[model samples]
Target: MPVTDVTTDPEQLTMTLTAEFEASVDRLWQVFSDPRQLERFWGPPTWPATFTSFDARPGGHAEYHMTGPKGERSSGRWEFLSIEAPRRFEVIDSFMGDDGAPLEGFPSMRMTFEFEADGSRARLRNTTYFDSAEALEQVVAMGAVEGSTTAMNQLDRVLTGLREYAQGKGTRVEELSDTLVRITRLIDGPRDLVWQAHNDPELMRQWMLGPDGWTMTACEPSQTVGDSYRYAWAPLEGTEGESFGFEGEVLVVDPPRRVVTTERMAGTDGPSTINDSVFEEEDGATLVILHIEYPDRETRDMILATGMAEGMEASYARLETVLAE
Candidate 1:
């Protein structure tokens, strides 16, 4: 019945998550490090938060304030533990009452964020360590699972935005629920250039989103259908993201022509329906089509509403530049 980590140690209730973005580690860090960038997606869309003093440095303090239904308010603070400059961080978090007083019975916890990269992707991990078993249980009971879910939801938007921004431009957009989002763009470059950027870590750093302070752990093609590759990304963004191990299965690989693979993240197994990346030739350029799908109506509509279409369009523009270079 756990939320984040749906698989092993469900009873443990401890969580870790990792995800690869279509942008670079530095771009992702900018979003996480800058408070202004989070203003649009820092909390639930319906019930967002207004943060204060998000100083992200060693020994710096951070705080968030929120007011849910019926005038309910929640505030918290964290004491900066250590910083590795855009890569890793440790901090303690605890809920506080409106009067700036820590909740009497709640347990304080320490959390860490770590990031790594793989080819055109980045792996990130966010791990939380509680002082004791009872402490962990108490926080879980208090709804850290769903709370983190909302946080990650906002996180997804931010990371996705940074990806678009890094590519130099982005637009707020969505696709029709029934209409498959077949995104195609022409990049005026050699086929090998596009393929290399997609397959090489050094080249990937120029155009993909990854964990903050990320490093490439592994990169290789899948040998057979259903054959999987593993890459360890720590300080998971959430339990589901962590389970995917920042790795996925290669369903189909045709080299520079086309590559089909499954993406893993903190989720419930068997990879979501998201699939497809194809490259074709057009007039003096390479036409790339990226088609990603969601399983159901509700999720598709939700994703569409998030304005990812515009973001993708912008990202593709940047990809063109990377490929051209």
Candidate 2:
């Protein structure tokens, strides 16, 4: 419930709303990029939005409908004009038909969102332009001002919950040596549950995807020493036959305590790495320590350069949701 400033200027033919969040810019960007996350805070308290389709790139289109408490529905669409990744985007927002087509004679608003980074916090400025002063007043009369303010107010709660989960899994990476990196976290779950979530393919798919738009096509984990596990990922929007493979052999398997494995990134032709994972519990919270050893320093550095920390943190945040479920 911070400052949610909403201003409507008929002279400028625009309605602008500015708000700040306690999360990082990247985290705030995810809420806009990921449709699943966007649905959580895109509507007022009495009316929750459900996105039927969403694509967060330039030239993409989004269709969603918000249902009222009395079963009334309001459908909308967004035609993205430009995108600057985690910083800003412009879209044409309008009322839509059930077939996902723009309705004729309807007043459309051009919305621009700018996300500014302020250290760990972020500031979001949104401006919605109308064709004329009358056009703006027409929508404002339909409750656009109140609905937007309410939706923006819900963002803090959604972002706070995500941050709390990420904090619980205190995931951090330490470069122990040239060829080795240590990743440690205190996961808010029991040891047995954590171990099962890691070894179970169905559970692994729920959280293993990083920030990419890829989906885990396959997860075959053999929970025994000398057995092999194969995990495959392909872009959710990619063409057929394009995929990345990761295969590993279980060297040691001690359930709820330790596991040793060797992993090779098949598509990248990257050097294989040996991973040793240990789990310890205190006060019903499991502490997970993972050591990844590469063949050489260059190999380890190369992987780290690909923003592995951010990707792993995103994955772990999803893992937190899984554990809570």
Candidate 3:
């Protein structure tokens, strides 16, 4: 899935969302540059959007209207502030009137979109800055979180189509058995870089995090067979938790090739889940195949119900950002 995280901080007067795509940075950037593609996923599925004008360069403008299922239209405008092709851009987003003028006395936000590349994968982070806490709360109260999440979900589907079209191959998620789930994707990076990103502690810390404001405070990766590793995560403040983390034992380690490990969740004495990651290089990109095996069907279903896929997607997205740097 493309969208992995969406967060709102009233005190900070900001909202941030992150997404991952199975495409190169330049390819993923087109979704924002091309008005037609932007409109396709810019709004919630229930509210289709149409763009009147779009100029992606700095000092350019974009205007669009999203029509609700009931035929109500919400007009929006973006005044581009800065632009860096295939990487980052900033704009001021505001409500607009039928005359293409920004509405007064309404919340206008400073929005920045950063596109980061990881081999053949891309990560996008959007940060929206509000004028004040009240302004931030206003949008949150207006269902911005729920709406953005839905819209981003639609973006993921659109990205999948783009990936399939570009590579002539589609990513896959399969339920191999009652207790196993398999995920496969072709990433545009050499096998060595992909392997290093997973094995190196510093590189792992860069992307193996949960979401915004959450970090992997401790990381110990033993890349050799029969070794153990531990990683701990610190949650955002006031999130009703002290800290939670996980540990695992490495079973097999083959450089730039494959790794097998059994992950054990902290605070739980349940069966440890086994993970096998295989990397294959074709041309210049790497094909990643990951198999996750649970102890039983009930355990697999329970973890799936917890939305683990989103967290995994977020982690992978962060990895893209790290790789880009």
Cα error of candidate 1 at position 32, Å: 1.7
Residue 234 C-alpha lDDT in model 3: 88
Q: Residue-wise lDDT of candidate 3 within 1-325, one digit each (tens)?
A: 5789998887788899998887788878887888767776787644556798998778888989886533467899899999999799999999997787887767999999999987788998999999999888888888898788767765654554533422434345667568778666666667899899887988888888765667788899888777788889887775545577888888766577667788888667757888877665656766666778888999888877776666766776666567667
**Model 1 Cα lDDT, one tens digit per residue, 1-325:** 1123411124554555444565566766676677655543454322345568887778888888654422346777877888885677788887888778887887777887776666765555777776666777776677665566545544543555333322322332334235334455556666677776676766654444343333334445353557765443333344233212346776655567556566554334744544466554433455555655656776657666755565445545666777666
As for model 1, its CA RMSD to the true structure in angstroms is 19.6
Which tens-of-lDDT digit does each residue in 1-325 have in candidate 2? Answer: 5346989999999999999889888888888988866876697654567798987778999989876533457899999999998899999999987676777767989999999987788999999999998899998998888788867875764566533423455578877668768686767788899888898888999998876576888889887777878898787765444677788788766577667788898655557898877665645677676778889998998988977788677777788789999
State model 3's lDDT.
0.77
Best by lDDT: 2
How well does each candidate superpose onto the true structure, as a TM-score? Answer: 0.46, 0.51, 0.50
Candidate 1 lDDT: 0.57
Listed per candidate, the RMSD to the true structure in angstroms reads 19.6, 20.4, 18.9
lDDT of 1 at 157: 38
The ten-residue window of minimal lDDT in model 2 covers 161-170
